[model samples]
Target chain A: MQKNQSIEIGALLLEIGALLMSAGANTNRIRLTMRRIAKSYGYKAEYLITHRAIMLTLQNPNGDLAFNQVKQTYAQVPNFMMVSGISRLSWRIVDENLSVETVWQEIERLKLLPKYPRLIILATVALACAAFCRLGGGNFTEMLIVFLASFSGLFIKQELGKKKVNPYFGVFLASFITTMICGVIGIWYPFQHDNMAFVTSVLYLIPGIPLINSISDIMDGNSLNGIIRALNGVVISFAIASGLLIAILIFNAV
Target chain B: MDWIDFFEKWIWFGVAAIGFAILFNVPKRTLIPIFIMAALGGSVKLVLLHWGDSLVLGTLLGAVLIGFLSIYAAHFKHSPPFVFAIPAVIPMVPGSYAYYTMKGIIKLSNNSNTTDFVPLLNDTITNGFKTLFILMAIAIGVFAPMLLTRRDSAKQIKMPLLKQDKK
Candidate 1:
């Protein structure tokens, strides 16, 4: 392959790596998928993947560096569809010997795919948190309280995201709002297991993907990336806890 | 547990998984499989808990089952396993434990008297450790299959130029 062709492939690989990283894929999966795609195109791929960026180098058949590029990854959004879609695309490239242009087109299509409607997401998440309350021995009233709290919390989070607020701050605000709602309701209603509502209300904000990915990365020997992800999870959890603390302090004063 | 209670818990577990799956925007086709896997995992954990097993042990076993099921479902649906596995295990996350741990820490800091310090510190430590261990269990359990089956090393690819240059 020509040097220019190799350069294009390197760029594509970097793009894929960036997309996967932003979609909350672990470092192992991103590295494996990129390497597979590079191998399919008759080049060896080397990468330094971090929380904020991916630096990729493509080596030609002679073991010479054909291309090197670095791309910045945005904040992770946990889009499993994008992660799965790109993983499948890598397999298709190897199995079908797909052209670079076809691969590029497919990536674009995956990016453009529509997400689930926001209202459905909100309802289901609220219901899920309510179910969580039930599992924790909450009564029906507590479930209802949790449902409303999580729904409103999630709505605030979504709106904050649209406004391009920092994600940690958004989580903090969401947790604060959810806990306040639950706490105030508990004070008025005086029901059994009211604490269950407080416990489950802000749960919709738990950074599950990041925490899981952090551990997987660490176990897979991507210690640097793993630590970064772990720190990210810690900060988000702290944001959530801090929000809850403030709400508790207010309740204590009351 | 009674049959009615078991079924209620199972169904709720599935709903919770579906909620998170949608939140993550997993492919529509994978949602049903995700629901089943998550519900089954939750049932396993619940059953174990009812039998007097530790929460960490129950979570680890349940997550392992989910991890294995996720690999199969991913194969059938042609998606990455994490897409299914992560959401399936979300319901089991120790969110309440973490919350309690945090609350305990705050209370400890705000306490003005030394009389209650021991119990407060004890409560904080227990909750903090529970949160950490349960999280570790979940991560390891869900990752076991992939770690065992897949090699992370890159495959070697031969190019025509290499042969031509050799000739």
Candidate 2:
């Protein structure tokens, strides 16, 4: 293959890696899928994947020609559709001997995959948090409070994200809003399971994917990336805690 | 728990999973299987907890069930297991323990007297450890099968041979 062709393949592989990483895939999946796709194109690919960037090296079978490139990844978003789409696309490339151009087109198509509407996402997530409240032994009234609290909290978070606010601050602000709503209602209502609502209201902010992905990354021998992801989870959790604390202090002051 | 209570818990588990799956933007076709798998996992944990099992142990078993079932579900749905497994396990997060841990820490920082400080410290430690261990249990349990299998079920693609150049 020509040097330009190899460069194209390397760029495509890096794009795939960055997409998978940002889509909340474990490092192992990113490594395996990228390698598999490169092998299908008659090249050997090696990747140095970090939380914020992916560096890929593609070489011909004889090891004489090599192409290297680094791509900065987008912000981490837990879109499983993109993760699964790219995984399936890698397999199609291997199975059908898809050309580099074809694979690139497929990647472009996957990028355009439609997401769930924002309003639907907001309602479902709020309902989920309310279910969490119920599981924590909350009464119906507490569940209703949690539902409203989380809905508004998630709305604020989404709006903050759209405005390019720092994500950790977005989480902190969202949780603060959620806790304030729950706490104020609890103080007035004095229900049996008010504590349950308070506990479950901010749960929609739990960094579930990052926490799990960190462990899986560690278990898969990518400790560096795992540690980075784990730290990311810790910071988000700390932001949440800080938000709750401030809300509790305000309640105390009142 | 009675049969009615058990079913109620199961339905809530399913609903929670569906909510999270939507939040994560999983493919629409895979939602039902995710719901079933999540409900089963949550039920396993609930039954174990009711049977006097430790919370960490019950969570581990539940996550294991979700992890293994997710493998099958991934094969059936042609999607990654994480799609099914992650949302399914969200219902089991130790949210209350985490909340209490934070609350304890804040109180601990505020109290100046040794008498209040000691118990606050203890409560913080206990809740903090519980939160850490439960999260570890869930993560380890949900990914154990995939780790042991050493291959992602959904991405087990065959490798093609490198073409040989003619002399």
Candidate 3:
């Protein structure tokens, strides 16, 4: 019985650590939370976090290794609701002292929690991009153009994302599509700010979360992870610029 | 800038933040607070800009205020500070600077416009530096509040989150 519980606790710690990392929590918090959760169940846990991986070890009271794990968490996608749920979960486990079975079930429940419906996401994202254009000094008509441009771009992105397309390619395609749409509109009436609508329309794909996380990780002293995330942001930025540049070149040529 | 025009932009900033909330799939229960926080951050920046501060300084102040407030919201909402804070600052990100940098680079690469090379070079350099500094200011500003608050966990009842989970 003792040995089985020990194995269960080790697996649970690693699972939780990977989940937190994937959901976009910073490295410091992941380690801190993992330690707290392990301590509650009478194990001492140490963790090492990198941009692409989480490594942790569990030690029994006798100073023997309980278990060790190195988990690779995939690139992050913004899911604030999931992240918050996951963050609260460690504390809940400690506060209520949930058993291994209950905790396992809870983890499954968190993973299966439904994301936002597609229609709402589409509409709000379009509106949000439109609002960004308005904030960029776009008038009402230009905002509408931006709305349609983002609407189509986000639509293409969601469809492609469902097929498991690489995110960089997804961003590239979406920027290409949105800029093309904006390009068509500009020919009718030149944009006041020289591609203002075209630019703001694709602002939704700015990889804001990674940029924010990169800085937070640095501030929390995880400089390596921070630099890694910052590099990821740069790659995504390049994807977007290339896509938009292609569309602009095509418009100029035509 | 006119006060009425200034106030109108914050409303749009709120509208824009709604998109971020949607993109992140923020739970409906916390959506309104996120919008208000985003709006406040954007408006604060604008107000600072109107007062003749540099773009970096204005963004810093706005992000700092929003960062502190988002933590308070997270406490009341019982979620992580980041969940609220990340979405709230989306409006203030320097999207235009990035776009201009791309344009300038593309222009420079043509290698045929010597007459405009100086201006193109200036545009790229200024926009690139502007984007970097503004982003750094935002990052540091948002974090300052969190760092300052961590030292005072003795008032646990007042600041329940200061005690643990370092990030």
Best by DockQ: 3
lDDT at A53 for candidate 1?
86
Give per-model TM-scores: 0.93, 0.94, 0.93
Please provide, for model 2 over A140-241, each residue's C-alpha lDDT reduced to its tens digit, 9 standing for 90 to 100: 899999999999999999999999999999999999999899888877887585377877889999999999999999998999999999999999999998
**Can you give the DockQ of every candidate in the order shown?**
0.55, 0.60, 0.62
Candidate closer to the true structure by DockQ (higher is better), 1 or 3: 3
- Provide the lowest-lDDT 10-residue window in model 2 chain A: A190-199
Error of 3 at B101 (Å): 1.6
lDDT of 1 at A230: 89
* Superposition TM-score, candidate 2 onto the true structure: 0.94
lDDT score, residue A54, model 3?
75
Which candidate, 2 or 3, has the higher lDDT?
Answer: 2
- Which digits, one per residue and each the tens of the lDDT, describe model 2 over residues B9-88? 89999988898899889999889998898899999999999996688899999999998888777766889888899999
With candidate 3 superimposed using the best TM-score fit, by how many Å does residue B75's alpha carbon deviate from the native?
1.0
Over the stretch B1-167, how does candidate 3's per-residue lDDT look in tens digits? 78788778988888888888878877677788888898899988998887867799999988898888877777677777777777788888888888888778877888586788998899799999999898888777767666776632111324544554433
